[model samples]
Every structure is written in C-alpha cells, then in structure tokens.
Target: MLRAIVKQGLRASSRLAVNRNPDTSSYVQQLEAEWETAKPFSELPGPTRWQIFRGFQKGGQYHQLGMDEVMRLYRKQFGDICLIPGLFGMPSTIFTFNEATFQRIYRTEGQWPVREGAEPVLHYRKNRKDEFFKDCVGLFSNGPQWGKLRSAVNPVLMQHRNVAIYLKPMQRVNRQFINRIRELRDKDSAEVPADFLSTVNHLTFESVATVALDEELGLLREVNQPPGARKLFKNIEVFMDSFFILGMKPSIYKYFPTPTYKRFSQASDEIFDTCSMYVNKAIERIERKTAQGSTKDEKSVLEQLLQIDRKFAIVLAMDMLMGGVDTTSTAIVGLLLSLAKNPEKQQILRKEILGKLPSTDRDFSLEDMKSLPYLRAFIKESMRVYPVIIGNVRSAGTDVVLYGYRVPKGTHLLMVNSFLLKDEHLFPRAEEFLPERWLRQKDGNEDSANVLINNSLNPFVYLPFGFGPRMCVGKRIVDLELELTVANLVRNFHIEYDYPTETTFKTTFLYKPNFPLKFKFTDVKY
Candidate 1:
C-alpha cells in the first residue's frame, strides 16, 4: 500500500512537471509546479490512527517492540519517510530519516524554531496558581516566548570564555567523583556496584551546581552533603522518568491530573522550590560581596546570568539542573563504556592526555583542553555511536517541502537521524570505535592519513547536539564537563568491563543504558 501511494505521487509530480510555462522564469515555474504536485499530507504512508491505537494496546507490536524499535520497523516498511497519525489527543507527527529532508527542514526553521515535546511541563507552568512562569516559560517554550529566554541566556552560557570559568570548579567536583569511585569499588573485584549510575548522577549534579548555583553541594562526599541536594537529585530523577510518560507518551495530563502527571507535578514543584532557595542564597551572597566591595575576576555562571535578570537567572538555573544532570551522566556512562569495551581506543586517548598533562596531579587549563584533539574526537565518536536522545524534534514553523510531501506549518517533525550515525555508507566501518575518523587533515597530525575521508558525508546526518538557533545552550559547559571527567578517569584508572555481554541502551526521555554498569576500575601505574 505504501509503495503504491509513493508511485502515484511520483507519477503526479512527473505529470505536473511537464506543464511548466515559458512566460515566467524557469526557477519560479519549477518551484510552483513542484508545490502543486506534491503529495497531500493524508497520502503520506504509515499506520492509520486506529492501527496506531491498537498497536500500542496490550500485547501489540508497538508494545512489544517499544518506540525505538517500532521506528526502525516503520523505516524498513515505509522507506525514509513515514507520517505517524497521532493517537490520544497528540498532534500528528512526521518521522523522516532522509538527510536532505533534515537539512531542508532545519535550514528553513526561521528566527524562532519551535521544539514541541515538553507539553506536560509547559502545561504545569502555565496553570500554576502563582503564575511564576508568566514572563518566561523557559528553554522548552516556543516562538517569541522561548526566544526571549534563549536570547537572555545565550551570551552567558554559549560563550567559551564564560563557560571556561567553570572548569576549575568542575575539576574539583571530578576529583571527588574519582575518589568516590575508589571508595565504592569492591576490594577484590575492583568493580563498582550495578547501581553505579546513581553515583554518576550525583557527580553530574555536583558539577552542574558548581556552575548553576556557585556552591559546592558535596554530593560525591562520603560524609556530609549540603541540605536539599539529595532531595533535588531524587526529584530530578522522578521528573525525567515521569516526563517520558506524560510528555512523550499519550496522556491527558492537561485536562485531568493523572497519577503520573501528579507525580511529575510534585517532582517539578520540589525541583523549582529547591533551586529557588539556592538561587536566593546565591543572590544574597552576591549582594554581600558587592556591599563589601569585593572584586572577584572569575564569577560563576549563575552570577553572570543574575546580572541580566533575577527571575531569568532562577528559571535558567532550574532548567539547567533538571536538564544537565541526567543527560550528561548518561552520556558520561556511554563514553566510559565505549572506552572500556575498546581498550586500544582508551589507551590512545590516554596517551594523548598524558602527552599534554604528563602527570595525574596536573590541573586542566583551557589551553590544555584546546590542544587535545584525540580527547575531543573520542567524545564526538562516542556521541555518534551512543546518542543520548534518539533524534531531534521541531514543529514546522512554516510550510515546507519534505521528501516530495508538503508539510503544513505547526506539524510536528521527528528527525530520526540516530540510525544514520551507524550507516556504513555515511561513515566507513561504522561499527568500529575509531576516533581518528573525526580528526581533520587540517590539524596536520599523524592520524590524518587514517581519517575516514568521505566527501559525501552530510553534516545534517550527524547532529548529536541539534542544529540552528535552538542548538543546546549548555553545549560548551557539557563539553568541558565530559572532557574533565574522562581526562581524570583515564589518567588514574585502567577502566574495564569484565562482563561477557555488552552494555545496551534504551530510549526513554533520553537514551540510557539498560544493563548493569558493573565496570572494573584498576589503578594505572606509571
């Protein structure tokens, strides 16, 4: 049925193309002809609304395979593009794996791109009695509202110089994390427990808090942690879990407060209150410093953001804490696993680190980070192989053509490019862990010859951090965090995973490892 529909569309397009007029410019006429012949949105191929509803029901294909696998199955059946009829009050979505379509959609996304996924959070913020979010709906918001928040925070978070200020503080947090790992590992086996991901979460929270709140939460400490830190951590966890259900899956969270929605709301409230308290403390501290006439050259991310607007600072801090912790921790775990499974690649990365630092005690400077190409390449490769999110989503900001179909404005577009990361045609030997593939020949390194030289590689196919104006604001910070953590770990430990099977990941709110993280960390002797 899908093949027949596609053929009919192609035939129609061909017939329309032959009717071009000679009076108008060829370019204008061609575009008009293409637009007129494009397939109707209804004729785009995928399972029907009833089929989607039944498929998600008990013991159905969607239920058995899960959304990630179901997407792959659809790709196989319907080719590169499929229109998913929304179920249970959700908007209809178009899923495309075509690189050209991805590029076209992103390039045309106007001044303010609309990323439509966090409906539950938006609904919660809008309906709050206090109207705390009336002025700013935060990073999850759309159009001019989101644009305002993003514009205010971009200079503070996106600049390299601004982000570099957090390196020393985050390094302190990484040291504690390394120490905590040593304490948690078994004496005989040298392996951390199956629940080591929790520890990683703590490490990430501590690191983010250093930048977001300008205070050491000491979450990785064995003895004393700051008050409300652990609660904030737990709440963020619940928020992530519930966000997947209420925001991603079908639910009537807006009309009626379901059990999942209630839990999500509660978690969100705690997260806001705790972050607000810390932000207030930060504000008082800043005021006190100012009163005393203190001139500190290096200010925290929060301090810089607070200079703009107090409320914006608080909202941005909360969003960073909620978004940064789980996502970064998950990415860190994935990178560590990649290093563990491929010992040679780990050693190569370690050699690069040691060549620059010479000793484990040496502190990471911004200069040191700039010189380490292999370290950066390793990170890029890891993300390519194990992307945290399945792909990016953007609501069509304007009428656009996608794979010969006219997508109307406000239609949800799911760009499923994760599969493209592993396509052999795009990246030669896509299964192997080769960091050298990311190294450019312009760097004039010995590994330049080994760099996978594919001229046809589309940049749009490999967007781990997304694209356009809505690209991740914390990208600079997250990059530094991953670099610091991995550098410290590799400098001190010979990481290994002794388990027979490989670590696998599942897609929830993000792509997280589904298996136990029982990694063995042996000390590296100089």
Candidate 2:
C-alpha cells in the first residue's frame, strides 16, 4: 500500500515538473507520498498515532521555546503522533490539549522509563561521571539499582521535618543571591549583568555545594566564578544541548563514523572531566565526615549518605548536585520571568509576604516563609507555565496498546506536561499568567489549596515537580527556597519591573526575567 502511494506520487510529480531528473523527481515523489500518507494521521483523534509522531518531532525540536510557545506548537499540531511530515515536515495536529494525558504519564513513571538508547547514554555518562550516577541514581538505573537509590534518597526529601536542619545554610545562600542582585542594581549601566541563567547556575550549584558538602562556593559573592564552578555549569549546558537539541537522531552514528558523532564524543569527555572534580570533592567530604563522627544533626547531605557506605554515599552526594542544579535553577528562572511579565501578580505576592513580616528586622526565618500564601501560588503558577523537564519520556519495554494505538517495545514515548499546563479544559484562559487560578477550590478538598489546577480547585493538573512515587525528591528543598527567598526579598525590598512591558521574557532551558530589573532593597516602612 505504501509502495503504491509512492508510485502514484511519482506519476503526479512527472506530470507537474517541466524537466524531471530522476533523482530530483524521485525525492520529491517520495516526500510528497510521505506527506500524503502522514496527512491522514492527523485525523486519528487518539494519542496513539498523534502522540508518538509529535514525540519524534519534539525529540527533533531543540529551540529555547518557552512554555507558551511549546504549547502553541503542540496545540496547533494536536494529536499527530506519526513522524511523517506536512507543509515541509511540520505537523498540523497540535498535541491533544489533554491534562489527564498529563496525569496518566505523571502518575505512571514505572510504566514509562527514562532509559534512552546508547547514543543518549554517551551524553549522560559525559555529564555525570560519578560512579553512582553511572550506577545508582534512578535517572541511570532501571529496576533494583533505581529502587535502591530512590529508597535511600527519597526519605531525605520526604521528611520535611529534617529540612529544619538545612535552614541555617539556606539562609546564607539565599542572602547571597539577593545581595548579588542588589550589587547588579547598584551597577551604573544598561545591560547591568543580565543573564538569569548564569545567575541561577551559580545559586543552585552553591546551594548543593553548601547543603551537600558544607562548603561555600561563594559564587553569588565572587566577582568572578570560583574554579570549576563556571566550567561545570557550561558542561551542563553543553550536555543539555547535545542531548535535547542538536543531538537527536544520534542512532545514525551508531552505524557510521561522522563529524557530528566525533563532536558528541568530545563533548562527552569535557562534561565528564568537569563533573569528576565535584565527585572527587564529594568523596573527600564523606571521608571527612566519617573521620569527624558526623551525626544526622551535624551532617551535610554527604555526611548522611556516608552512613550508608562511604563510596556509595559520595557518588550519591555528587548525584544530588548534578540533579539538583539544572531543575531548580530552571524553575527559579521561570518564576522570575513570570513575575516580570505579570507585575500585578508580583505585587500581590509581595503583599502576602509583607503582610506576614512587618519588616526585614534582621533576616529570614523558615517559619516566616510558610504563611505567604500568594507567594507560594505565584511560584506554583510560574512552574505550571514554564516547567523545566516538560515531562518524562518512557519506553514500553513490551508491546502495549494505549488508547488503541499499537506501541511496540523499544519505541521512545513522550508524555507532555507543557501541553496540559495550558489546556483550556483544565484552566480558564489557559495561556494567561493568573496565579489566582491556583487559589480556589471546587467540591471542597480545601487542602488541595497548594495544588495547581486543583480539580478540587479547577481538574488536577500540576507536574512541574512531577507526581507520585518517582516525583522529584528535591521538591521540599525547592519549595522551602522559593517561599523563603520571595518572602524575604519582598519583606525587605520593593522588587518591581524595570524592563519595558514588552519582551521581558527570554528562554534557555527555561523562561527568565531580563536582569537589571533592580529588585530595589529598601528598608521596609514599618
């Protein structure tokens, strides 16, 4: 049937072209036939054909698309799951605006796995050289290895009771970030040290450095980045680019030697070489903890992990650093951009903060962060709009039927989050930045107040931090940081938009506010 269509396209092309060279005409004939065949796929309403096809295209797409742009493309091309093209390879079916589809994937990661082909492994190994990353983290392992590390690591995050232990270090780090912003504001220039990516890159790495290792990188305070700090982040950026962006379709290199393949190998080395330093440092810290008889009350992340097994804990500690940096930094950048675009919302959040704390007084306390309702809502809303991971990718391991589409074993499957976050079925005026959307409840499970698109509040749609057992283990830390940071800044300073209403947003990994916005640190008017 496919051959017949191709032959028919050849006949059609022969009639259309004035001078037909066989190679030229044959390629056109092939592409035209593919388009014609793929056109029917858009008509299939289920996720089967549409979701898979869009997965491939999205796999191929590497733009710095903000959440809005990504959703717009997904909707415009809804439910086209096959990879064959139309209008020069662009799909017409936007992804189904299905938040339940989002729910299905988020709630079901055991059903879907992150195991990419060996080509992607090269990239992962390059950026994460730690033995535990190579062997332990759920990101790398599948069954027992994933279960073991996940079991050990997740408890650390789940027990928010323990976060109180982290409070003192986090206060020092958050102050560094706010002070860095203040220093930039004082700078007398237009560009005035923009690039929120670079800013967040420093903060998160420093957080993990202190929280995990009890070391101060001082990235926020340093006039220049500390040794290995800048390089490690650059390697992270490269690894992300090589994996998500220009690095798709790497299977071709599995069979042949090519320039692109060579570059991938080189990048893999640079990423690994840079990451090794951190891992080695982690090992040293774990040993030091053992020598010093560190207890839970006195332990850093490395110290606690060392209780498990020294080497294992060291690698796992490094794993925490690698995993923690990109996700939270991406999120903070997203929150800042959303705040910039929604000045009214930012002011509302600030009020929630100021209402709680009469003044900065001395500095932020963890207890002060909890009561800021709108502040939390503002961060939740931003995460909804410009999520970092966008959602997990899974492999079916065996043949399965999803919504009646035949999904064979070994096919890469995507479950999209950006599509659902803006699904009109889930929220009103889906694309607008309305933090208030998170504040209401439906049939009255008032505890769902913190839930995004709370069905009790709006249809159960929130996966920026992911859902269920495999959901992000670092969520509590991120939440604590966000609520604390925003509350402290707003309590002490008047942070307002300095950039024009237009083009306040930029994307690279996630949305970001143009800096030089000068979150002016004024003494609170008591």
Q: How close is candidate 2 to the true structure, as a TM-score?
A: 0.71
| Model 2, residue 43: C-alpha shift (Å) | 11
Q: What is the C-alpha RMSD of each candidate to the true structure, in Å?
A: 8.8, 14.3
Q: Model 1: clashing residue pairs?
A: none
Which lDDT tens digits does candidate 2 get at residues 1-526?
Answer: 3233334534443343323223355644653454443434224443344443455464534244554465456546645342222222222222333444344332223422444322354444545535434543333555445445555665555577768767778878888877776666544432224454577677787776666555676678757667676665565555555544333321344445355555555665565565456656766766686688873445566556545554455545445665677777767766666765676776777777767666655555667666666777778877877767544545544443333244444445555555566766566566788776667555765323344343543233566765444566677877877776666666655554455546545543334454444333343456
Clashes of 2: 19
- Which segments of candidate 2 are over 4 A away from where they belong? 1-97, 104-119, 122-138, 186-192, 246-296, 397-400, 408-410, 440-460, 498-526
RMSD of 1: 8.8
Whole-model lDDT, model 2:
0.55
